[model samples]
Target: MSQHESRWSLAHTGNRILLAVIAGALIACLCGGTDLPVATQLVILLGVGGVTYALVTLLHRTRR
Candidate 1:
């Protein structure tokens, strides 16, 4: 494998922004004392992450 391909990165600005949004959501849930069950929270987070990944890829390709 190439050295560049082997490294981990959130190299795009869109990716970094999505990461911050995920973190902010977690903090808000914690501070606001949300009553979401563990399973529900996990599903919601995974859904958000999946959608973010898809949107970033879609937007990045068009911009390129």
Candidate 2:
């Protein structure tokens, strides 16, 4: 692929990862400072992150 395409792909991936990390942190906060189950919280966080990433990618692509 061309340099531009590669850059765009990298940008998209970076955005997804950044958003996912933020979402995970938010989820961790929502879980509170307790020693309880974490799997569910993690799943929810990941789901939200994935959706956000997808929407962002779509918007970026369309705007181009």
Candidate 3:
């Protein structure tokens, strides 16, 4: 495998995806992309992000 591929582990990829999700959500909120209130949006974002992180962590551990 290429050095780049070896260095880019599953855990790292998962983190990047999580970060992207958070950034996108923030952008959407700031841009008024949704009708929901800011507090509601934040709550939804946290719930989704928490579940996604848990799933990623579980998969990473199982692969070991």
Instruction: Please state the error at residue 42 of candidate 2 in Å.
Output: 1.0
Better of 1 and 3 by TM-score: 3
lDDT (tens digit, per residue) of candidate 2 on 1-64: 6555565352668856787678767876777666656776777777877877777777767877
Q: lDDT of each structure?
A: 0.62, 0.71, 0.66
RMSD (Å) of each candidate, 1 decimal? 6.2, 4.0, 4.6
- Write out the backbone clash pairs for model 3: none
Off by over 4 Å in 1: 1-32
TM-score: model 2 vs. ground truth: 0.61
Q: Model 2: residues >4 Å from true position, as ranges?
A: 1-12, 33-36
Q: Which stretches of candidate 3 lie over 4 Å from their true place?
A: 1-5, 12-32
Write model 3 residue lDDT over 7-51, tens digit each, in one string.
456568756476647755765566467687877777776666666
> Considering TM-score, where higher is better, how would the candidates rank from best to worst?
2, 3, 1
In Å, residue 52's CA in model 3 sits off its true spot by 0.7
The candidate that achieves the highest lDDT relative to the unseen native structure: 2
Q: Per-residue alpha-carbon lDDT of model 1 for 1-58, expressed as tens digits?
A: 6446222345566655677568646754664567877777766666666666666667
